[model samples]
Target: MTSPRRTFAIISHPDAGKTTLTEKLLVAGGAIHLAGEVKARGANRRARSDWMKIEQQRGISVTSSVMTFERAFDDLGVITFNLLDTPGHEDFSEDTYRTLTAVDSAVMVIDAARGIEAQTRKLFEVCRLRSVPIITFVNKVDREGRPVFELLDEIADMLALDVAPMSWPIGMGGEFEGVLDLETGGVSRPEGDSRNFQGKVDTDVTLPERFAEEVELAQAGYAEFDAEAYRNGDLTPVYFGSALKDFGVAELIDALARHAPAPRPQPAEPAPIAPEADEVTGFVFKVQANMDPNHRDRIAFMRLCSGTFKRGMKLTPTGHGKPIAVHSPILFFAQNREVADEAFPGDIIGIPNHGTLRVGDTLSERADIRFTGLPNFAPEILRRVALKDPTKTKQLRKALDDMAEEGVTQVFYPEIGSNWIVGVVGQLQLEVLISRLEAEYKVAAGLEPAPFDTARWVTGDAGDLKAFADLNRGAMAKDRDGNPVFLAKSAWEIGYVADRYPKVRFNATRER
Candidate 1:
């Protein structure tokens, strides 16, 4: 029998302590030794998940990271946990969306002080769209935050999610004594200055007399925890704690193993693929380049949907109906990885590939099964790449192509110029592009202001599109995939051009 798998993502707005929580969860699972603060210098301070230099410098997760670890639960036996840490910045929403498609559920991290934020709401909507159940973790309870009722009401009102507080804080900020587990009635408090987990949860259903009425009232106000409702994405079982303090993370993991659904059937063409399906089926939700800067390797993050995937198996990618051997299937704990001899449903395995595998490419024993819903959003920002050395133009082209395939940026070749244009959704992406260009590719390139501010896919009759393209040849360009796109100078220009060419459709997003 397959080991039980719980695949989920951690999402939040910027500075919600999602990264800290991720580290603590890893420590609890025995994946790592310690959960150190970001301020601590040297190797000891570095987070395993935040491996990129740019990430370390900027203190942000610009790309989604895939991490896997395992732990034993008394009720569920030993279970495999796959955690995808998504970027909190709204700019990386595209990457987050793709990562969500590959998970069974998500852990929505909201700051107790700020409550539901803009990026958090956006990510929640993405989760809701796919019916992805969420386990809410209200972090920073050790610090001063909004009242419990206010936060819970905001969750109920803003997200429309039924709030089920699994655990409640005894008090907040300096007065914060500990958290009382509602289900187990176990209480654990901070022991010393370290704030590490006490590891001793008194399973007595006793509550402090002072806070008894408050707990009672809050429990009465919110709906009871219904496993069915949560699995259906109608409700969220909330846990409150300070991830920085290593509080409530263990309970959060327990909640995941106990309540979170196992590898569910994945949406695919023809029919949804069940976990027990005979054929080995999976889809590439992300392709990252230069994960190992030394070897310049490219890895495709594939989420197994069905069957037992063994090493040295040849799976055909839907992108190119050709069989590719996956020799080095990797099970990841952030950047630390090991060769996965075999993987089951809901397991995310890293398949090192060349340019053949891409985001949204489905790999299976056969070519017929193609998983869907990975999207490619049109770039919100475009810039012309000016290489420091013109002699290295070919190398820059190769690097840009590699990055494009990885979804880090989109490279567009215009019908007009030799200088290729790179596009991204936000300003940070431009910084990442330049950083990677120097660090990984050994080709230093600078991004100059592009004439076009926005780009859109042009779709319509061949004659009509050609007529439009012919009229505005300067704005015409082809994506790496050879798809025609019209680069508009600005939003107003897009509107003006659309008015003139009514038959042509300008798509902001394209199906991968």
Candidate 2:
């Protein structure tokens, strides 16, 4: 038998305190003693388990960080948590989409004052599309002035979530008192001693006279929502806290262990390939590149979607060359990396693999299984680049190749004189590419402004193509459904010149 595990993601819009909440959770769950803040140390902060340096400096998470923490609940001695802290920015939204494939549920963090923003809606849609359970956390109640009740109402209306409070703030803003535990009816306020209030919650704190009626009405509303959800089939439960001040955090942890979906022996590992009858399968979600004085290693972070992975086992990765050692999963705890010998179903395992295993590649004991590759993403932006010194031109190519291998961003080499373009979704990504090339490969690259190209493809009737040739003007084309096609740059957009159109003809200037 295996200890129960919960696989969930922490997601939010920018500056909503998702990472801060993550650090606090790690410490409270006994995973780490010292929590590092991204702002305090710039890059000196040991890159957290999932976040990279580029993310910390920009104060934005591009890649979802994978971390595990353990806590005992009720009679269960050890509950393992495999958490994916997803990026809040729209540019790295693909990272969040890929995470949905592995996680069983999501903890949506909404800024209390801002209520629900654009990215929050997008993230919620992703969770809804996948039918993953959702647990909403309303954060940031410590900022000078905030309306607690109004924020809660706004969240419910914006997210259309049946808001249920597992814990509620005892006060508001700077004078914020404590949290009222919904289940245990306890209050734990913020103070120097707040961190010490772990599993033991105080049930006998008297509510201030001003909030007495408000608390009662709020509690009643929460009970009604929970009761209705229970009557139906939805299991999602909402909770609240000030992540910055550590208010209502312990209760949130308790709710995570108690209410969030737990890993079970899935009947079959999910695969997108044919026959649909196959053994369990899993995929590597992240890879950590570590170079130390003694050893240089590449750790593949995997999700066990189907079967179990044991220590010292050898397995072939899908769509890649040879077999690699399964040296064991690892936990980055107390500034030390230790090997975890066995990984059960739904567990996020970090195995030592030197082979080429991309983020979305799948792994399975049975050769017959395969899943649809990771979700598709549009590379909408491009930049022109040149080597700072012509002497390092060759080295720049090699540096770009290495960056591709590490999954930094998509790189394409066009015609010789063509703008040495690199495709990314945003500007910050371009900067990281340059920094990585200079730091790791000793190649300095310079960036030049490039015009944005609209991706277009031809898929309509050839008869209408005649109109296109008469004008000789090109505009971004959309499909019948209006979705821009992927990899459209390489696709042919045929514009027929006359009323009589040939089924297919290419202009001489068009690249074959």
Candidate 3:
């Protein structure tokens, strides 16, 4: 029998050493010989899992990147690891949700110095809502003066997580040295340092007096977690480490293998749909187009929701003159592409040599049940761009279409001949697009900050005035102008703004 697979997503606030953690995990699992670093300029600079050009330049992940790792578990024997690395920014939260929906659990990384911030809380809530088990890691303990205990308390309070430390920090802040594994009672520190350890605990150590006390306290806390505690509904476990120094990484890997839940049994394939259903039958989650002298090609990343896709599969895709044959089954790995001979239920595989798949469009392998809805995209932040040369307008349109297909961007054409309006998740996202355009297509796009609406609810005359001004680009909206406009239609947007601008009290009657 085949070994079971475990799927989990890694999430965190921006710059919290998430990619660093991922690299360590991949290395520990023997997926790569030596770990790669995120350099400002280099051949392999960005997150190894983060393969997008836009993502590398921005230094922020805009989409979830999936990769598999395998390692032996002390208790579970051999395990297949299916890990998804998610975006840290708020605008890409929708992408994060989709990634989570496909996985069984998550590892939430937090900065030791910064503790839990707004995005951390938001993502945690989403996990809670999905009832996904989560493990929390407090990273960057190598930095001096980091308050490990205090950060642990903050994580539990801010995120309301039932967290217990799996290891104790040997020292914190500037004097930080290593970690004491609570389970094995082993001590692992920087390799070169001459720190003698008799067993799991150190003897005659020079650790901070307060830290020594905290170690004992941390062990006690772990002891307190009984089967009943887990059964009664606790969702998070806290671990400490410095990904930069690689200290405690082994223990973290061990904890993941031990505590993280395995993916549930794969469900039986869905029944075949009829030969004709107009409800938008298949989903195009990814797209890549290549044009060379010999061949003009487009690869559509698809997930067959309710049908089977085999060799010679056929479907009448929208905007196509006739049903195109499934020319070849393909798989996308960042810039590299390959062909998969067959694909089936719940598998995300790519297809090449076809013209019909659009981001968010559904496809049908059989003709019966259809998947109509596109995964939700957050409200776009509007910006103005002028082509460096008028002649490059057509080239720019094709480039933008590819970007949209990749799901990292949104392009809007307000009018037929208007200067193109590109909706982006954040400023960094725009910078990345421009950089890619100039370098790859020899086109430099000039961007000008444009006024955009992030609606806030207000009711009292003062509140109404403020709300109206925000809608008209007058007051608070102007103050926070560059931010992406909050979708006025979403209750989440309404409640978020209402709490943010409490002074602009809502008149229940008017709101209704």
Candidate 4:
């Protein structure tokens, strides 16, 4: 029998209740006893997924977290869920993008009052590009918000997705009663707090007499669910509830178990690999440094695409081409992890990194196939990093190299032999890097504005690339991986280079 698996990521704009929704899902899944708030006061518990110190202090997820657990539905039996909670802040969008590549589907959380925001729109576009199926959660329904139809229309207009309501809110704001399940036409009301409501009647056979109007609205919304459109990725199944109250979480989980797609074959260079392929195949989508402070270790997050992964399994990392033992394969519940003896397709496992692994690298028992679709975009912001104490230069260099390998920031070596240039997608990434350098690496670092405003990786014949580099020595540089890069002072300079070096193709992102 096939393994029941559902691998998906949670995405949204900042403060759209993504983290809260994640906690509620975990609670409903029986992964944890109590759901923790993102910004709990005093000694109160914080979110499990936001385990990084920077995240806890700021109450924002700066990195993507992988969580694995199981939940059982009435009809679906036990289903394994690999949940990837991604950063909602725009500064960490690159991290989110990489995380998206590893998941089979995505759950997009939108604030009921705010509808779709900028970050949500950007992430939705990425999902559309990959044709990843999306399930919508209209959160914070206990608070006053726009009409459900307006929110649906906005999603359709802005994100170009057909909205299919799977569950409807009974009432809004202070009068918030519960949610109506469209499939069963049953009413699910919160018994009290979510913790107390656990295992209580999620679906009632008879509707309460006081919710007569809500029943009619739910019936109307229930009639709008189009299975055909939903299956095509053209439509999204929408669920409404207060994640804080955990009213509609169980229904959402049920829908996911019944409807979400299972592990699917992903495209590789030579061919697509089936999830049931005998060979063990996976791709490293993220590398995190200092998840454990004591060891100062790094972790490579690999999403197993095929076959079974045993602890200490011997596999070839495509980048190195040498056989290496997969040591202490781990499964994560936020920062907390346990030794994983075996893992299957659609499950993400963390491998200890000692400088050998890099993001986008693939590993397999066979050496022929290389996974594709993971690409690095050109940095929009450029800065020159300087070490405050020259004595700690070695430590600083090692830390910077580790961060670059993790794809947190791009380090560049200028041909002029000046200070190392730091390239980042946004200013906030640079800030996080500096903050980490001081807090984690104990290195005092400063950033100075660099002359370049844009960068591109040049691809063409070796001779042509050489000629371009020689002609533009001032603008020429090499990234951390020794890839050739051309920095431009402005758009005009990029245009001028394109006109001058017509033989070489300049790409905004490096082709994987």
Which candidate tops TM-score? 1
lDDT tens per residue, model 4, 1-512: 65698999999988989999999898888898877773455656777788777788878888899999899767778999999999888877778888888988889999888888887888888788778889998888877777766677778777677666666565431243234333444444444423211121235333455455544554455436665566568788777777887768887888778778889898897999899899999999999989888998889999999998999998888867798899799999987899999999999999996878888888999777789888888888899998899898889888888888777788888999668898888777887898899889999989998989989888899999998889889888988888899998987888888998899988888744
Worst 10 residues of 1 by lDDT: 193-202
Q: What is the TM-score of each candidate against the true structure?
A: 0.92, 0.76, 0.67, 0.91
Badly placed stretches (over 4 Å) of model 1 are 1-3, 38-41, 172-210
Q: How close is candidate 2 to the true structure, as a TM-score?
A: 0.76
Residue 313 lDDT in model 3?
68
Q: Which residue pairs in candidate 1 have backbone atoms (N, alpha carbon, C) closer than 3 angstroms, thus clashing?
A: none
Ranking by lDDT: 1, 4, 2, 3
Q: Whose lDDT is higher: candidate 1's or candidate 3's?
A: 1
lDDT of 4: 0.81
In Å, residue 43's CA in model 2 sits off its true spot by 7.8
Total backbone collisions for each predicted model: 0, 4, 16, 0
Task: Identify the runs in model 2 with alpha carbons over 4 angstroms from their true place.
Answer: 1-3, 38-51, 172-203, 222-236, 264-280, 288-297, 333-336, 390-407, 415-418, 451-512
Predicted candidate 2 versus true structure: per-residue lDDT over 1-512, tens digit per residue: 43377888888888888878888888788886655763346454543543454565677676667778888877767788888888777666655776776777778887766777887878887777666778777776555334666666666676566766555555432233334333344433444434322221234444444555565666676434453362232534556677766776786787677666565333222424221223446776655554221354666667776555677766667755456666666755423567877776667767665546656566776444455535434356756677778888777776665444344555554322444556565566677788767655677778885443323333345554445433333233222223322122332322322123444233221110
Predicted candidate 3 versus true structure: per-residue lDDT over 14-84, tens digit per residue: 98988888888888887765666733346666667666566676677776765556798666787767667
Q: For residue 390, give model 2's deviation from the true position in Å.
A: 4.3
Give the residue spans of candidate 4 off by over 4 A.
38-44, 172-228
Top lDDT model: 1
Go through the candidates in order and give the C-alpha RMSD of each one to the true structure. 3.9, 7.3, 9.2, 4.2
